[model samples]
Target chain A: MKISEKLARETLLEMQRRMLRIRLFDERASKMVKRGYIPGTVHTSIGQEAQVVGACMALKSGDHMTGNHRSHGHPIGMGSPLGPLMAELVGKATGVCKGKGGSLHLADYAVGSLGESGITGSSIPIAVGAGLSAQVLGEDRVALTFFGDGTANQGVLYESMNLASAYKLPVIFLCENNFYALSTPSHTVTGGRIVDRAAGFGMPGVRVDDGQDVMAVYDAVAEAVDRARRGEGPSLVEVMTYRFREHSEGLRINVDYRNSEEKQFWTARDPIVLFREALIAAGIATAAEMDAIEAEIAQEVEDCASFALESPDPEPSVAFEHLFTDAYDLEDVL
Target chain B: MSVMTYIGAIGAAQQEAMSADPRVIIIGEDVEANVYGTTGGGKQRAEQGDFVQQFGKNRIRNTPISEEAIVGTAIGAAMTGLRPIVDLSYSSFLYMAMDQFVNQAAKNRYMFGGQSSIPVVFRSAMFYGLNTGAHHSDRPYPMFMNVPGLKIMAPASAYDAKGLLRSAIDSDDPVLTFEAVPLWGAKEEVPDEEYRIPFGVARTRREGCDVTVVGVSGSLPLALQAAEDMAARGVSCEVIDPRTLVPLDTGTIVRSVLKTGRLVIAEPAHRTCGAAAEIAAVVADKAQHALVAPIKRVCALNMQVPFSPALEAQIYPTRERIVAAIEAVCADQLNAENRRVG
Candidate 1:
């Protein structure tokens, strides 16, 4: 696959911009949490930016995606506005879910980011349904669902995989193996190799070892998405990534979950640093241009924080609103 | 009007909904084989005539023994654009898919700020008259009613079974339709023409001025029979059937209680925290001024449904129990009146 100079440059810059935005957004969100601007904890996607950007970049705008709890980067990768995402984190009325769903339940349907679930691996079945809908309605759209290696143990994930295979629904199951299911090692909790389980469902399974390399992640996800859209059913792609921070925002720093040497190894392979080096080596962009892009993303993330801070808290009287779609009078039940 | 069995009415409702809308699909265990007979089992029941041949194997899918996947898939499909009708076979099996049913499907609309609506109908056969024992026979509508976003319907008659199901399938919210397994063979006049019974509306089966008796699902017929028996003894009894439990028609029940000045709630579920308790509370809160006697509840004993036929019969509400409750309320009223006159 020969990539045109212009297309490759644009793709590389866009991926870098998305990774920068996620990194900066999480940095700002962590500060906001400390200052009490954000109400609940956020599961930041600090080190797994390339996985989110690569898989989401390969998808078209009309294609669907279901994200996990540690999914602050997904909406950005899917082209959702940063203001609404930030406002939602602060529990403001201007938030995407009107302050109802916090960081974990972020959703932006405009960019085909269907929704993210607080439940682990729950979105897999939902993505299958979306894929099934496309097949039933005779649309050419595909659905991509992102979950952690911890979700590999969820029974519903296997059920969704079997159903997707049986019905030949257009779906890509991307497992972001971050090696931890909240302080527990994935290998200790998971029975076998996560990618090998896809073979049991009779679907093609691939593993991208260098998740920091955006091109590798993109190439693997692009192939899987293509196979799905071509009516070849579902495929599983396991992106071996790592998270730089704690599982949640307010967790103790020295939780003895992973050793200091292991953290140092992943920190050295930072996705943004590696991608920045790749782009400069390939003459896609100069070091000065990359620095300028980072500065611009930092300002954009600051603007999102300001917008969220200025947004008002939701009125308490309307707490019971949006419980149902129909005109159900609460007075009747009372 | 066409005479149809309760099971046949359910099949007719699904077939009619499927024929009318292309998006409506049925996913269940052994739907193609019709093994459980709820989807007009075994093909001899005229309601499910040529379903597999007409709709093909794609729409009428047979799932593996995965209840969680069955409901989760339907919720997903419904969240997208497909209107799915998922059959969980037995109401007791709902325990298996509690996470999907209670957490995911019921809370998705509210938790997502109403951005998503699950137009899925979880159909399950309920009740224990057939001696299916404890595991197969529990009526779990009260458990579902505890959830906010779920609409629960337990149709008592063939006509209501067909009509309410059409409405449930057409509804944009998640609906759990509990078809009484004992009433599957019960025959009644169901309209051949397409019709829908809206939720939260109570049907006044028999009008009377002396006392009010409320029935739900399988208990409606028992209440009506007890009403007939009470009428022979000159105690006129009004019977009300709340078709949908979540969107309960408290107005109808309250008004009937105000008119009759006596209330007796009859249900097959256990006595504690059951549908009867909810109705009794509504009447006590809203129409307590008109009460001539204490509200009586003719409900099943607070014990597990026994496997033995005789024990199950003793445990559940009977026409005799309903009659006895009505007589007690009437007698209590008479004693109060006598005390006031003295």
Candidate 2:
């Protein structure tokens, strides 16, 4: 069903908060990296706010999802506490993964957020396996996974999809096709539309209008999530979004990735603006109220950064610890 | 009462483990009535229970032929509180899942800074014999033993195999148990009960005076054979089988080397960076003063193992090489002692 009247207000409220959190976190992380506060760079999920919020909103308690490098938006969308996400980026003990897993590996399975892997398309197989586990455990949980448009071309993705479909696993393959895979565009790199590729795997496929509104993305995911819980196997959903920011903070500027005009063109139709307008049109929120929400989230993220900065670094031995239940002679092995 | 082969001991141990603990689940290719599974076996053996029926399939999960995915999921499950016995039917297939093994399971506990434990056990068979060729045959104990987070156990005899396999299963950390194929057909009487041999302890199968011989995997038998022929030749050698390589029971080996003053390491695999090198290095490092002469290693030539019987015989380490290597070490010891006396 399209956004039910009851869910419309709640969905709009969720849309505004999540979009703001993701965009704010990404912008702050970008600035932190630039200011040398966060050591490593991040593949900020800046402009692609709807994919994370929409897909996660569609999931239930048992449903889980895995993310990719551009995962800041992903965890934010999964209701991850912004404090831990910021702490992890800043390499503090207070981080979600205790600072071990930087931006790429943030995970809290409790929130149905499994993890985001460093290797592209690696999480697809894990999602498949976790979906398989959910099926075996009789949890009726769907594992929703997001890989870039380029990841659709990887052999492992195809393999994972085939295996999931073969087992009729409760998995949702969410292809966030932001046009380019690093420097390569969808036209040059991918063979065809990711939907067609999903068709080849014998799974129901959809190409959602990622840019027009968040509800469209949410509706497509709701259908897929429903089908997954009913044990109808997996579905491939290619959300046509755009990457608003550069790949990572360390990247000075994308040299040949996309034209400046194209980047400018997509930034105008930002999901945050569309979501705010939707809320305003529905009389659920005012422009002033939206600004206050933005301010509130901004303050929360700012405190998260300060908390990350104030936290102590893990002891040196902490680095070498956990290799084994029993202590290992690392010096001996070396 | 019944004589059992190494393979039988393993099967019995699995049946016993599954029967004893509901948590003990098995996952692998062909584990459920497949070609290599228990489907083709004897009538008296009672048809093997598929993982689905035995462990409820929920625990005894199967997956596609992706070793990476198999191992990755197993590691994930183990971390999330499940004791999984993942089977990499062939030891060589381990190459495909090395990241999950070496990187994830091996490093997860440490990466999370000891926040979690992976109580998963990986079982695979290794041996150069059986004409499986190079691809199917490899003794990866040396490669895995060096991994810090993992406990690598490769048993040479039937008793050690059963006991060590049991212990590896119970370990809180991830453990690797490599069953030697050549020893699979070798039969012996194992106690019809439960037992476990702790890792790092060495078992001395034989005792002598002139030289100390350390062997692992299928090479132990060849060492015992050489000891017999050498005993007749007046070169009495002590054979020490360090049952578990990583947690090496160097105490027994060092004590033997202290008495004999000469040492020789024999293995059925390549010499460079093999288990042989690790043992020799350990001896030279810890038992330096005890060694009368530099340690000598007798191992497979650094070359491809061929299918032809003659070439295969020449390619792998044999009793002749062990005997020769022991003799050379003894001769060198005698020469050094003589020089000192003079």
> What digit string (tens of lDDT, one per residue) describes model 2 on residues B55-156?
565555556687876776666556544567887878888888776677666775655445557788888887577776778777767788767788888888
- TM-score, model 2 to reference: 0.90
The models' CA-based lDDT, in order, is 0.87, 0.77
User: Once model 2 is optimally superposed onto the true structure by TM-score, how far is the C-alpha of residue A192 displaced, in angstroms?
Assistant: 2.5
Stretches of candidate 1 exceeding 4 Å from the true structure: A1-7, B38-49, B333-342
- DockQ for every model comes to 0.67, 0.37
| Tens digit per residue, CA lDDT, model 1, B123-174 | 9988577787888878888888888889989889999998999999999999
Interface RMSD of each: 1.3, 3.0
Retained true contacts (fraction), each candidate:
0.57, 0.27
Cα misplacement distance, residue B208 of candidate 2 (Å): 4.3
Model 1 lDDT at residue B114: 67
Candidate 2, which segments miss by more than 4 Å at Cα? A1-12, A326-334, B21-24, B37-44, B47-63, B114-116, B146-148, B208-210, B234-236, B246-259, B332-342
- Per-residue error for A254 in candidate 1, Å, reads 5.3
In terms of lDDT, the poorest run of 10 residues in model 2 chain B is B34-43
Binned by DockQ into CAPRI classes (incorrect, acceptable, medium, high), candidate 2 is acceptable
